[model samples]
Target: MDDPYKLHATAMPLEQRRAALTALAGKIRSGGTELGWQVTWNVDYGDFTWLIGGHINNIGDPFDDNEFSSETKAVERAVLDYFAELWGIPPPHDPQDRNSYWGFLLTMGASEGNIYGLWNARDYFLGKDLLLPEHSSGDGVEPREPVLLYSVESHYSVGKTAHVLLLETPADVGARRYPGQCPIEGEWPQGVPATGGGSGPGTIDVHALRALVEFFAARHHPVIVVLNAGTTFKGACDDIAAVNEILAECYSATTGPSWQTRPGNGGRPDRRSWYWIHVDGALGAAYLPFFAMAPERADLESGIPVPAFDFAVPGVCSMVVSAHKWIGSPWPGGVYLTRNRYRMRPPPFPEYVGSADTMLAGSRNGQTAVVMWDFLARNSYETQTTEAVTALRLARYTEAKLTALQHNSDHVPDLWVGRSPWSLSIRFRRPAQDIVDEFGLSGMRVQVQGADRAYVHLYIMRDTPRDRIDALIRRLAEPGAF
Candidate 1:
């Protein structure tokens, strides 16, 4: 035998193999941590968090601009410019002033993407001189008023940004998250800007907002109006078109009715004001352009044309979209699109030691960007929309199955109904967890109904097949399974 063992093993190094495998295992475990988060909603994290990259086509991607050799970068440039417009920056303003997609700072995840936009908005709008309140400005200056307005439904990062801004770092941007409803009685905030007084409840109310705009129209508070494209829990969108309408009306006339003080008592709104909409679509925005809000009843197609609410929208200044969750990317990746590149600002913080422009990460792993770019280069709105619609249909189909499974459930004693696809939250009642155990006993692992009075949860996806759906229904309705 001539070195049988070595020759058979092809002289591969076991040490190298061991090292690679160890690294991979650690990655898998870390991935679980993120997967478990499930966008802070925790439950349906299974339906769409780390879906792989086996095929060349996926609705979860929109990076298809890479295929054009004749104008690959050109296409991206055009797209960037389009986004610049979408974010409401005039020509030669925002990111258009500098090249982004190429010299771009790609993020490792959506949080980083949000951070990136936050940095820009903070820095470009506020400047480094007053970044730190405690630190001498090198010229001895006091800190400027730092604030960003968002809803309570907003992710926790806004508060994190505020923490960073309290420091002396130049990248800090203080953020203020507005409670969606009133703390006392579900009312909105009231103030006339420069007056700096609460006009109302400081909450988000359409009519209340109109009143505040009027009350402070003489010159309003100069603040950033950060809007959420998709909230984490409910996945509902704040009306953009209507918001635009509100802004237009408020700015046009400084005087309007106020719920704060009577017109007879007489306090007027300041009008010197303006603001921007920073879209936090970390979980929901990516799917917006392509998915129908209500496939069961809308005249929309697989991907209905939506109002360009990106920078393209008149007042929209920036946008953040997560690639990992809905994009189906592995673990991490996100993109921050902005209109005013110069306006991009970083919060002053000791934690931030690098360029005030790039958010969170000064240097990110290139692999994520490669994957993100690849996804965008190979997918289209139609494909993505169709896939999302398919997912929605799957969800609808699952609902029907649940309906059938519980058709005669009145006699079953512990049977229930369920719903999904972010359309509507629905549930049915059951007395015991025995029916819940039925799924696990049948080898299809599923948790007992949660939150909704103990009804099983489902987040049916686009790829689920009809036959499988039918089988699931059959199993649930199995004689005595309840």
Candidate 2:
């Protein structure tokens, strides 16, 4: 076979290129049973096929239209409005209202949102005016350098974002990566340890987090926390409400007279602590609200619980949700939402775009916004509730079947199987390589009951039906499957 990864110096014949694409499309259709990821496979954008012919770019802010006539800012605004209302923050009624929500469509999924949110938090605490020159001075008490805190279970993007933003981490400070602003910590060298052995798997330990926040808050360092609404592997959500309470407590403790009374004594009381909470809700934020609103649809009596991790929670400053995860899109895209009060002022407006470049990527895909709008408009609140309920029900059914296979099998009597609370994924002993490839399963190695074990997980999406689950179970029941 020719090297598919290589690019030929000369362009390929049009007939040959068309034949290759047609063959690839057949492969994709045949492998549609791959249900190991959190993406909805049953999506058809045939009505929007005309968009491929035009070059549409949503340059600059989604709420503001640039000179480019082909932009879809209006549809993008409607999409943002839908998410803002869903996440418990009202949409921007007026462009000048600082209290209303302000955000833009993301081109690179949740990673871009994470970077943008943390970048804003870092600048906000550092007292750097976004619209001013690099060395321009600010008119407030200069805050100490900020520290980044996130659970070990968070997506890899969080740690990468920390590095990109130049924020201090436990490992960075210990290795003397930079000036090492925050004091050294104990036990959590990589990141904040998560609770997995206990009932709340993949969730951040609130007590441990509170202690860490207090240690930094007392030392006068601003803190930035990245909470997970639905983790990648285990699908766990951290307790945002509990973390907010801890921040409030630390804030009160740091603002005492002992820290406030300085030599400057400008008669203006100063706050000694600053904190920002950004929720990385790539999977859950898109559909969890519907589960919350219609709890009667799910089997909540079985102990699975849905927690709040949006703007409704007092301390949550910003959040990001992927359109390709819960809500299916042809390509990777998402939205990053934050209040206008928290939006960092962009650098001087660009005349080329005729609008302020507030978004991370100045040029974004207008087609993503239009697709998201179409999905939201076609699916009403009740329809979303039904879909969410149905997905959860299928997940429960799969878990039950897997558990039965473990108990009933004599060859693999000790088969390990588990699922986190309110999770759409189920973990079991890793099957043979052929079965894994056939079903598109994701594999991981973890310590289970004090021993290393290989596990594979299956994510139940809207396209994952009961028959597909049965087929997966049948493959696992084969002789020597484990």
Candidate 3:
């Protein structure tokens, strides 16, 4: 009698367990009400909630054969086609042409997309095969190792990807202390000195970027430029158009007209593009397209100051965007887009899968694709535009409130400052740790010029209401509230 019930029912019964789960759900919902993170993009999956049942795996390429799971591929393609149009990748005409774009749903958020995009660029430029005839002399000599150019404000994932790919060492000063020394563990020497203006905390300084690219191109090394579209910390966006112009001036100056028009018997583009520009638009990619002019408007006279980080920029080779950021998917997933010609050779035919292993991960998340598709399908451009407008409006409103507080509040004189006009993050001096914990605020310590300053960031995402901002501002302005 003592053993019969004890061993079989060590845990609570179903009724009791359900009650505990209900309690947990109430707590989570209460916590969700206080959600303050600007990077969090939560969505209501509604009808698509049924997709969570069973094992849904998107093995192999999304556009190619999917031996494991084929049901989600069509939905995934619709997602890609929508983004391709948004990013300015030309639609495929005839099946024989490589004019269309190629991409896949990434399972591991933007980090995976970043690595995949960089890997493609590395292989395209530094791989054994040469796509374009060199502008410089290189008949028998090997090309210099490709150099990665990104602002100090770029996401940490960029640096991590570089290290993981053995591209460069992070924060390692190789030859300074010891003469003729290489980094011990894939660490590069110190990076370029940080400058002010766009180079400060968010955006990239185009002049500094140009100088770095020229420094590398002068030595015959191909360059990969990671342009930030809405940086992680301060929500800064690099000048993609300016960067493109700099590429034309810095990297391609040595070549003549025929340098790009190598007599390829076909009517394809010549190899004028010497370097690659990958837009890390984890936050802004989904948001900017709403403000941009319709793709048919070639003159680009939209009057919107939005920076072009898409195919409209001739030098841009690829872009990585996180659906989990602004697009509001359930899980961490993203989209990686590149030209059809620039895609790396996939692994040899996997007989079992009946498709080449082109994507970064083998067993992809088909459910994430469906979630994204549901979100995208329900929200048209008009709906997204309305939401984008509201978010930015609230962001500006929050900044104005903060600025007023900085001017009036005695306890906090220099309270808040906004980044670029297009940014959504409003950074200010850090408040008490209790408030930070209460509101779920994110903090960072950054070095500006010579001084180290602590700042708290608030990202004004879609769901963030005006009342929430007002409440935070009021709490921040309260007297004796350090």
Candidate 4:
């Protein structure tokens, strides 16, 4: 019996709507029991929820002129300022000037950020030094094609981004070196491309990367490097400092017709930077800074012993971090930060919203910025530092617990655990299907040493307490309890 109230246009009764929402809320709350995923589900956005009621559209650039919609663009500015300060990016001296550090909240998670960052890099390199001018017959100028390099473990969005932007991806270039395998010089099916995938998770083989950079440099092509700060699978972090050093070497190296150069020779050593490094710190960028800034972690000297994959890295021209992942925002949101010099690659123009169209998205999520701002405002730096320390400690505890279980068990013979020193993702042997489903674990079958192995990943979030981890460990240790 189809009730007239259930038809379209005629809205459901207030009571029915309330009841439906209440039921959904309960189911969602129940799902929050197992905190094995990356996001913190228990986050209360608090007073910022009020902003959702209004039709707020943060169109155009936040840093540019705005006179139309009365959205909370100012809060967005504060959020960017906080991140800029944290990442060592200096803001423009003048408020109206768009020639320094520029950043904005993005709508489509870190994927959007990745696209924006790569787009910026592509435009920057192409527009900097003209290689060839366009023909008078209406053909566009052919700039030196920029090569893109990223680890195999980089977010799948990176590959998609390359496709969307019409850039040559690694797969397109045919650089397919599996982990622990190197490409044979003469045996390559086609000409060797840029960098090969790293042997470790979320890392780029610096040796291979150098080779790739050199290969492109020989042809005078610009290189763009994407270093993973925290990867999706095994949570491996590429050595940003090492990569920076390699790029610096390539940037300053001298090459001439005879491979010999003197002061008066035409080979001025390509004084312009030949490479750009963009840190994909989507998972770690939000919290790692807190760990690095904590008082207890100060004695550790650089906290994680890595110089960090933030703006602090000299070669890092841009970075993208997810606010939804570590910062506990309700919706999928992220921040993309780049040098002001690189941001204006797309010439500024008057947008319909009265501001310049500088951002990746046309009509951006206004509420996302408000939520992020509210979260950041509520959580102080010291509190965030404590939270970061706690997350790392929990990861260590999880790893130790799994190791202990492996030590005591005979069934799980080759229990391989993979995790970076400063990451929250703990990768280990996959358990029974039921247990995995109960805990909401992310499982995948991966190849290790030419053997297929089933692995499950657990992400330690802020709300994941010690007791929750203990419960999971107990179940895992139980005989025949897989």
Point out where model 1 deviates above 4 Å.
Answer: 1-106, 124-147, 166-219, 255-273, 291-308, 345-359, 400-408, 411-482
Model 4, 152-269: lDDT tens per residue? 6788888788788887643444444232222334232222222332224546667767776665555556678888888777666788888888777764573321121112113222
Give the Cα error of residue 53 in candidate 2, in Å. 1.3
Off by over 4 Å in 3: 1-36, 40-42, 92-96, 129-142, 169-201, 255-273, 293-304
- On TM-score, who's better, 1 or 3? 3
- Using lDDT as the measure, name the better of candidate 1 and candidate 2: 2
> Model 4 Cα displacement at 372 (Å)?
2.0
lDDT of 4: 0.70
Candidate 3 lDDT at 252 equals 55
Q: Report model 3's TM-score to 2 decimal places.
A: 0.84
Cα TM-score of candidate 4: 0.84
- For model 3, how does the per-residue alpha-carbon lDDT over 1-482 read when each residue is reduced to its tens digit? 33322324477688766776787777655544443454453456677756776778788877676556545888888888888888898654222345568888888888898999988777766552332323332222234566777777788888888888766422332233334433222234334333463326567766656655665555556677888788887887778898888877875564321133222323333343467889999988989888663442232222446777898887888898887778776678888888765665565778888767877888888887787788787888888877877787788788788899888866786764755657788888888887787777788887765677778788888787788788888888887656
TM-scores for all candidates: the values are 0.56, 0.90, 0.84, 0.84
Model 3 worst lDDT run, 10 consecutive residues: 256-265
Question: In model 2, which runs have C-alpha deviations exceeding 4 angstroms?
Answer: 4-6, 130-142, 174-188, 197-200, 256-273, 295-305
Candidate with the greatest lDDT versus the true structure: 2
Q: Would you give me the overall lDDT of model 1?
A: 0.43
* Candidate numbers, best TM-score first, in rank order: 2, 3, 4, 1
Error of 2 at 328 (Å): 0.4
lDDT of 1 by residue, 1-482 (tens): 44323334465478866776787777564432221122221123343223232222111112323331322233333443433432444333233333232123244565665665666556533433211122111221212333455555456675566456542111122113333422222344322121111111112445544544343333433345556665443343555566666766764564332211111112221111244466776755665556543344254323434434454455665677765666555556555665322332233532332223233553344334444455555666567677666655665655665666566555544444533124322234432355444321111122332332333343333333467456545655655654
Whole-model lDDT per candidate? 0.43, 0.78, 0.70, 0.70
Q: Give candidate 3's error at residue 32 in angstroms.
A: 3.4
lDDT of 3: 0.70
lDDT of 3 at 356: 70
